[model samples]
Target: MNSASSIQESRDEIVPSGPLIRLSLWVGDRNLPFWVLSIGMIVMLLWAGAFKMTKPGAEGIIPLVSNSPLISWQFKLLGPYMGSNMIGATEWTAALLFIVGYARPKAGLIGALITTIMFFITSTMLVSTPDATIAWKGFRYMNNLGLFLFKDVISLGVSLYFISYYGRRVMLDEARTDS
Candidate 1:
């Protein structure tokens, strides 16, 4: 081959090879929207975390952090502020990792899974029902948390989308590599 052709071949050889790379190239790069969504979650969660730090006056509509009978006062036994602080930090970290696209796929899906589980616990405390949140429709106290639950559902859906798209590509790449 000519020198020019040889140089082109070497450059091509340096390019990434895998289903993830191919899928990324084919998607026309819409990951920016994912980053936005992920960051927005982080900001809100951090605000919640800060509220937890303040204690007795966390600024939020839901009084769940302060007055929910569902979450025991025993969380106070762990230095009085550990529960809410840890929860907030976890949320912030998950969302931050996702926004930066550092393990974006795993972050999205696993983050949602964690949140979904938290919400399920919250719903259970409120209604004493199983994981089926919709089953807790009658009590006024439980109903008050509806908005929070609804938003979590949305988060779950978006996270699922991230998992479905990027996660599948990652898996595909791994599978191809193994073969």
Candidate 2:
């Protein structure tokens, strides 16, 4: 090989792979991925649920909630202000249960189920919320409402993972006890 070509090859061999590759490998670890997902889920739930507890934050979602047929009865019976409070309370309760899951497997399993249901309901907003689509770059696309609701897909996936993992753990414990 020519001197320049040999030097380039040597440099390539000595240098490490790109960070993205390294990160992919690191996250590919079975346990690490779950822990990362769990931490991210916890942060998102805590932050979002905390906001739901506040007046401004709770009020902001009124239109969306009111529009949803599945939940609009809450708005009607409780009224906007009180209904918002109730929704906030529900979110906060689910988030707290998820936090407790870290220490208690049974509690964690219930939290995971609650979280899964919450995300599933929110994800349905893509259909229930009005004007969920918009024209973007001459192509029809999800509007902000759709975009906001669509992120529940990730949350749903994470919740399912928690359910499967914790559910299995709980079941195994039960079986061991029975035996």
Candidate 3:
């Protein structure tokens, strides 16, 4: 084969063209990532909310709850068990909103807002909780607690995405109705 033909063949190989490419394009074009994030958040929120309602789960989060300035009031007002239950109830409500948001953007926007607040509070635990970090070699490293709290940062971002996505969708929908 001539160099020109070989180059053309190389170019064709370099340019992705197949079922995988088509599938990726389709997934990207549609809002598959957003849906996946939403579904995953819903499942996690449901599971975590259920767990928080349990004795062990409520007991386990004592340190974080007691330490957090944002939510410590709950513990003071309701005590540990009841306070945890209240948080669990909030999570369940947010999860339910997320489920309904699939059909209603306004609902999803509210859910996302709630989730954002939740994550923002939890993420602050990295700084508020003493055991969250360990000083190693004169540098601070995240311990298990810190690492766990750190995941909330990513969750916060996801919630933010949900906020923007749903917010824009709601506005567009309203605009269309008005028009």
Candidate 4:
């Protein structure tokens, strides 16, 4: 018991219990937010997957192009692959794995990497295409609507935050214990 207390004292000496501890936990350290965000992303990805599996219509994330008077030629290169459902399915697999919190350090990195790519690709499309011109104007997005966009933004942020958190010894211990 004395040794344990000594260890605790040593730990306290380094971390110093206070708002910093809580803040770290909330943002990227040993907090539940990281897991919550990960699982949330997974659930949303699944929801999107279900949407694709169910009501696949012209008004979909990708099919919305038909509603407009003119479709861009640039999107042709993307074709069906750029469709909302297709992209959701691709991301769902990764997000689901991440949501479960297995190999979180690695999972965090993967989620961040994929979300980063998604952010860049979507932003680029929104900027280059006339249809998505609204997104270029400012904080606003293009014609694309729904929680999917919101989820992507959150995932991108959480993934980045978690990656930093995963660096801490606390995360390493968690990963090691789980393994």
Candidate 5:
């Protein structure tokens, strides 16, 4: 082979086109992608909930929760420590349920629905959080914490998607079993 031909052959041999693409395609097609996303959400929920259970974390959020009309009653009823722990417990419950959903299709759909509601509440944090949209400090768009909460909207949407996806699979499986 000529030098140019040899170089072309070497280039062709060196390039890898299929592995990443194939892996992504496989993940997208299978339940693996949903599980992957669920794992991510689980981590976030577990971390946030566990952290909120800590004294400092609970104390830090006291004002924020206390200020919200929707949740303030809880704070008043439970006090800061118990109130934060309650929220943390709720988060942990969601995470645990989400994990179980991995093995059980119907349960997973329920988990996804729960996640959608949880994120929906967090998304509302944009409105309830006092410093969510700090502007004078040059915070715009997602420059502030409020803007950061916007991602929950996407998370909520993904949870809803999982519900539809898993719900259909579960229903189809049930129909097959019945038939």
Candidate 6:
């Protein structure tokens, strides 16, 4: 066979087939992945916000909140339960925005921005919270609290993605109407 045909054959072999092709198509559609990410963020925010409103949850975050320069004032001003409740209310608002954003890209953009700020703040707890890391020999490893805070890094990335995607979508929609 000619080199061109051999290359084509190899390409065909590498390409997805059968059920894999269908799965690939589903992922490639963009909407599925976007909604999946949106749902995940919404669920997390709602659950976490609800938890924070509770006394136990408020107490649980005391150490992290106390150490945080950005939010420490809240604890002092509102005290533990009230301060945590305020944070929870913010989360609930963001979650509601995400739900509304499904129908409106502008709302989604706002939600994404809120989520970005929230995750960024939480991620910082890894550095600010004492005992977040454990020293073993020369290397530092995350403790349980550190591990918990580290998840915020992933959430931060997701929020950023939502921002970019929704931002572009909103811009494109506006451009279409303007033209």
Clashing residue pairs found in predicted model 1: none
lDDT of 1 by residue, 10-32 (tens): 85786768989877755534676
Error of 4 at 16 (Å): 8.6
Q: RMSD for all candidates, in order, please.
A: 10.4, 10.2, 8.3, 7.3, 10.0, 6.5
Give the winner by TM-score: 1 or 5: 5
Model 5 alpha-carbon drift over 4 Å, by segment: 1-24, 136-140
Strongest candidate by TM-score: 3
Tens-place lDDT digits, model 3, residues 1-179: 86657977785676568999878867976979998999999999999999999999999999998999998998999999998898899999999999999889999999999999999999898889888999999998999988999999999999999999999889878978999
> In model 4, what is the error at residue 50, expressed in angstroms?
2.7
TM-score of 4: 0.53
lDDT tens per residue, model 4, 1-179 = 55647976786678547997767745754557756766676676677666654446313545334332243332354554355445666567666646543554565556556656655454333334445424454666545453334445555566566556544534567657999
Native-to-model Cα distance after best TM-score fit, residue 128 in candidate 5, in Å: 2.1
Position 20, candidate 4: lDDT: 77
How should the candidates be ordered by lDDT, best one leading? 3, 6, 2, 5, 1, 4
lDDT of 2 by residue, 18-47 (tens): 998777655664578778887787778777
Instruction: Give the poorly placed runs of model 6, Cα more than 4 Å off.
Output: 1-23
Q: Arrange candidates by TM-score, descending.
A: 3, 6, 2, 5, 4, 1
The TM-score values for the models, in the order shown, are 0.52, 0.77, 0.85, 0.53, 0.74, 0.84
Cα lDDT for residue 117, model 6? 94
Please give the lDDT score at residue 32 for candidate 4: 72
Global lDDT of model 3: 0.91
Shift of residue 56 alpha carbon in model 6, Å: 0.5
Candidate 4: Cα lDDT at 108: 54
Model 1: number of backbone collisions? 0
Which whole-number lDDT from 0 to 100 does residue 17 have in model 2? 85
